[model samples]
Target: MFDVPLMNRYGLLAAAMSVLLCATAGPARGEEISLQKAVEIAVQNNVELNAFRKEEGLREAAKTKAGLLPNPTLELSLESGALTGNSGENAFSVGVSQEFLLAGKREKRLALAQKELEVYRWQLADRERLLRLDAKARFYQVLLAVRKLKLAEGGIELNRHLYQVAKERLAAGDIPELELNLVQVELARSEGAKTAALEAVLSSRAELSLLLGGSEVDPALPTGPLEAGGAVKEAQGDLFRLALERRPDLKALRAEAEKGSAELSLAQAEGVPNLTAGLGLKRDTTTVEVAGLEGKDTSYTVGITLSMPIPLFDKNQSGVREASVRRDTAGSRLAVAVKRVEREVATAYASLSNAEQLLSLYLRNVMPQLEENLKLTSEAYQLGEVPVLTVFEEQKKYLEVNQGYLEALNQRQQALFKLEAAAATELTGGVH
Candidate 1:
């Protein structure tokens, strides 16, 4: 059915072959990239996508088989030799036989193949969407990890200064040794926290590397802010309808159901026996005595043969039943997928809104006041109006609050990805 020109066909083949070979067209190693760039790299270089691109080649092969006719068979025969001779004559025959598919079986097979091709296309698209969404989430996770590490490192610096204050207060006999010792213990905890944060950075970076389809991925951080996405605008639309229209996984399930129906039709068509027929040339030779003289006689004949199976035993009943069951199963799965998408949309919408509200509240009313409180508490401790432990507690609270803001931002972005996955389409002007 394709009307592609020869040059276009070659171009398509080359593109598919490049995907099959996992040829990358991404930024070079050690280059900093945005989340969109990371997803693009993954789509272009992932071996999993390469595997999916090969499915088309397999489907094309099946299509070729389905559209083909049976080959003609040649046969030769010799009969009535001297060993079993009754008339002292030999006969030789040459024949060609052809089997004809009955009940439009070839047409049914082609329909099934076409349906399978449709299903494969949907599946590949679904996989690509899934990979891109996952890459976005993992990319943000790495950013979150880096933000946390920085928070932890800054905590150590803050705690170190507090420890110095406590030490000076101890030397002046304004604080007990026990107070200085407590502050020293908190300083050690912050040190351990920094080390833990460093470890977390390594692991999360590795995971992002894996998502980018390489172990040698750059350690450089992604170039985009975690707070740039998640508008919750899709929630205002008819989300369920949008998911039905756009989700590739849902479309794939629908195509699978169609494929199942086609397969059932193919199975029904396979029940009837095919017609086999042969056409041949035959020859006979004999020697006879006429008027006391030996004479030779030769006869040539044309013969035809035709046959078909009786279908007395198995007539593809098992095949039809299996196909019917599978088709029903596919329909049930499609229904389930639809409902799952609905839940996903609802949940992601709620999460994105919650994250937005949390970040807004933190910025407007919570974070500013908290920072002011931390500054006041530190000054009070330096003036000996508050205990060293109070300053230590305030510093911890400050670190946690800032970390919470970054977490909210990351969560909102991740929620955007989840919504995209649910809709099976990225929000327009939201993310790449």
Candidate 2:
């Protein structure tokens, strides 16, 4: 009678109840924060996300750099025969040259920078999506720990009551010392379980504190239901479609493909050599001795010149090739991302379905009978009608059944979190 399979089958359930109780105790040490609050804190204060946001500034600066024109060149020259001992012969020229971008290279470069900025925005959004998911998961873990602590406390109360009954029976000469000793042992075990459950609450809260960027000494208590109401109403195929439409990582990859296309276009534009035009004023003063007579000549002239590279060999062929490869690689990655999302949605969908089924079983069939059974068994044992072992078994069943119910609740919430993360879209009726 002491070796009941029902209690053993739901051992994990009891652990979860103990966690819940401990969570309740946590509020006394620190203020309570709801799930939404936790998520907001994580998004705002997380160090990595803050650092990643700086990239937006860098991308914006790149756009400014891309749109700017090349600087104008200034040229000045003096030609003299002084070095050759003919200082009387000298010339001076002043010129300004501007290299004009040809084939719309500047516009193409600006377009590429814009596409790059889009890709980074999507990437950062995806990172925030992941961060939100992690915060929710950690919050749920703390909730589970609190529930487990509650279960442990309940167990202790039941064991203490049973111990009193056992002592009474032993004192009345109706039971042996060994039976009473068994109840004391159970009571002590319950106390130890409570201690462990309390420790679990602290550890879970510490984890959540780290995620929320809070001090561990003052970790906020999670304030929400362990069994928050939510359901997955969409079919697997529909969820997969939603993932394709909403997943930021997938969006980032598509943006990257567009960026690669822009890069290729820019590379082709760069292959067209730029035109440099110059305008200059020239002055020359020359002196010469001809026919034994000294003569001097002074002249001034204005001229315009235009020049360009021949592009005989390197026409950005390597750059074009690299960009083409990049575009192809991006396309391949997007295809792979689609497949991976499909698998994730399917897996999370099935997991949610299974958790719901288990919780339904506990709610409709098993849990309602457990309390009455334990009550009757306790009364019968006290009246000397049932064996002490029967009381122990029933009490164990009571605690484990409650534990199992909470465990199912926790598992369902965990499944919901995974589904939301996989799809990269918030689902209705999820933990709040």
Candidate 3:
């Protein structure tokens, strides 16, 4: 049965609660920066990426230079000088010559330039991926610091309470003054821990700020479980093959080898020699009789000349040899990169697996036991059956376990990040 009056009351209560939450959450949400926002800021303002952009512009200019035609050489001369005492016999000449490329040098250079550009494109993407990984790692560090500070503050409060209880108990002769003094000393220690944790939080924030272009981040931490990240995918077959296809550094090396091949070919092409041809105008003056008429005559003569250097002494064998050796070196380096990627993938997988198991054990077994023990010990202390110091001792153990759990989770995340770097792929979209 639908109760109209009860339904109305429940609807009003839900609406009021929604309004209250919004009212309280508005300012905090405004000041808080999300992980996605942090990544965006870092990527957009990254110094290395900006420098790469400038270098890209320079490479494009080089491509343009590679495609340009050779400029012509201009020439001028005086055939007869006045010192010969033949003023009217003076002859002047003007000529232009151009050397035309005989082999596929320009095309090969352009192709190599394009490949180099492709390499830079992929390198830029790889760089961004690394930058985003760094930002996410620092974000996680900040969250860890925030959690530690909370633990320290709580420890201080609990120890201060114990100190108070000890004072009362000592006044009534229920316990010795030594216990009270010990409790006081413990409270001081907690305060020291709290101070160190606070300093750590500040230092973490400063580091993150540097990554984020010096913008100060709010203290309100990211709102999510640290373990909430992408799972490691199953590697079915040929992960190395995938790395070869995707790894940008490897691609850059391959591009260098291709460029070296082109360079070697260019050196051989230079050995083929370019044809240089010249066209010129020569002035000639003579007095002669053409058939039956005699008159003073002026004439212009057209002259053509062709020349090229013989490939006898320097046939570019040294240049070709140098380029071939460099190409071989690039290939060897690529092989080394392949070996490195394979090892990194295997090692990272092992670390991630170990971290996963330890985290599971802590959550499923150790954490609960520690929590139960701490709760019971605290209750016992309140009932005067146990010393307050005993409760603190249990808490100290609990704190260590929690800290270890956080560290394990951190290691798991690090391993995943390393896998991403090695594979040139994202394990997580990185929002976590």
Best by TM-score: 2
The local lDDT score (0 to 100) that residue 87 gets in candidate 2 is: 84
User: What tens digits encode model 2's per-residue C-alpha lDDT throughout 155-210?
Assistant: 88777667766665677788899998888899999899899989998998888888
lDDT of 3 by residue, 1-432 (tens): 122343443343344334322322221232377777887888888676777777998779888988987899999987654576554455778999988788887887787678768778767877877787798788777766766766666666666655655665676667778888888888898889889988987998888877876564555444444563766775813545566677777777787778778777777887787789999998865456678986656678889999998989988889889888988897898788778878877786777778888888987999778767866675565446887668768868866776677677767777777666667666554321
Candidate 3 structure, TM-score to reference = 0.85
Between candidates 1 and 2, the lDDT winner: 2
**Candidate 2 off by > 4 Å:** 1-31, 216-219, 289-296, 429-432
Q: What is each predicted model's overall lDDT from 0 to 1?
A: 0.77, 0.82, 0.71
Can you tell me which runs of candidate 3 are displaced by over 4 Å?
A: 1-31, 216-223, 236-241, 286-297, 429-432
Per-model RMSD to reference:
15.3, 5.8, 8.7
Cα error, candidate 1, residue 345 (Å): 1.0
- With candidate 2 superimposed using the best TM-score fit, by how many Å does residue 59's alpha carbon deviate from the native? 1.1
Residue 211 shift from truth in candidate 3, angstroms: 2.2
TM-score against truth, every candidate: 0.86, 0.88, 0.85
112: Cα error in model 2, Å: 0.7
Model 1 per-residue lDDT tens digits across residues 92-112: 889999999999999999998
Q: Say which prediction, candidate 2 or candidate 3, comes out ahead on TM-score.
A: 2
lDDT score, candidate 1, position 341: 86
RMSD, candidate 2, Å: 5.8
Ranking by lDDT: 2, 1, 3
